[model samples]
Target: MSQNSLRVVWVYPDLLSTYGDQGNVLVLERRARQRRLDVQRVDIRSDQPIPTSGDIYLIGGGEDRPQRLAAERLRRDGGLNRAVANGAIVFSVCAGYQILGHEFINDLGQREQGLGLLDVISTRGEGERCVGDVLADIDDRLGLPPLTGFENHQGITHVGPNARPFARTRIGKGNGTGDGTEGAYNDTVFGTYMHGPVMARNPHISDLLIKLALDVNALPPVDDRWYEALRNERIAAATQPS
Candidate 1:
């Protein structure tokens, strides 16, 4: 681990603080440190330029209005798409997921196009806001145990022609249909609605994300033992009712 290797950035357009998505960034840093990887964090605000060199980029969840506002800014600035195109592993959650796609329409009759990095569309409308601990049976591509996390989104996501669903719904919404829409992964980019600061508590997914970043850097897989341990503990704890 050297000063040059583990640089990661958190993009802050709006509501990053409100939803506590910053916790995900902390989780990434802590895990990286545990693996003896060097770490740097850059938080990008509206007026600031997004640095292109980071290995990973994080975008957190926010309110509907703020989501739209952030989308407008990123659409105008064009830095986010460039980072993704240049091979940075980007992970966006909830509203962040919505903005990474082609378009999003929230429950209040608001509609806006997103960065169009993915071939999915999100629309918030009349539906139960799926909340609480969620479970997704692991698909073969992820190659991890089943995923569990918190989901709080009014948006119903429908994967477009070019996209694939990351997990099938076992507990909550997986791909926006009644079966549930858990997340989407395309190449090195990951998007999802789940966040208990998802990567903080769910390190298995974090490892998957790190693998993507490592692929970009042509680095070998760092040991993922911690991710396995955390997943086992979280699953056991989840099984015990409060």
Candidate 2:
């Protein structure tokens, strides 16, 4: 990792400014700084050229209308797909997640086409919000702690035949009732409903993403030492929830 050369882009307006989604960008910036990596932030909107490539791409959650608008703009731009093809690590949360898929049905009787960057599909929300702590039992390869975060979305996501469920919800409605699904992950992209600026305290996941981006870009992974200390702290926090 160069001491001053990591480029990260966040898709704009169509982006969800609410719910502290920008915090994810801040988290990545801080973590990269700790590792001596320079972080550059960019925002792409309807009129701008979607960056051809970046180390990471982040889109935060938003209301249904904005979600639809963002999805439409992205679909029109077609640059998002191109960037993904060029090997950009993409992470979308809540509405952002929905927009990445083939389609999403909102609480209203409306259907919006997703960017199809991901294989998962989402159905119309049940008007019931799933807001609470989310726990996912990810395997060791993911190198993540059992996570706890809040969910406040009404959409019921269904993983497509080609997708993988990232986590199972232990405290809120995930994929289905009872044995509900939580989050989805494919290649280097991850979609989850957890908010509270999830990435801030979840540096392990951030590291995983940074590593994935570097790997996809054919760059060496970020050194483990910078992330190890934070991972241990998060693990301890997970084990003893306050």
The best candidate by TM-score is 1
Deviating ranges (above 4 Å) for candidate 1: 1-4, 106-108, 216-242
Report the Cα lDDT for residue 104, model 1. 91
What value of lDDT does candidate 2 attain over all alpha carbons? Answer: 0.73
**lDDT top scorer:** 1
lDDT of 2 by residue, 57-132 (tens): 8889888777777777788888878888887788888888888988888535588888888888888655667765
What TM value does model 1 have?
0.86
Q: Write the per-residue lDDT of candidate 1 for residues 138-236, one digit (tens) a residue.
A: 668777778777777777887776767777767666556665557777886778887777776576676666656765333335666776677677666
Residue pair clashes in candidate 1: 173-180, 173-181, 174-180, 174-181, 174-182, 175-180, 175-181
The collision pairs in model 2 are 175-181
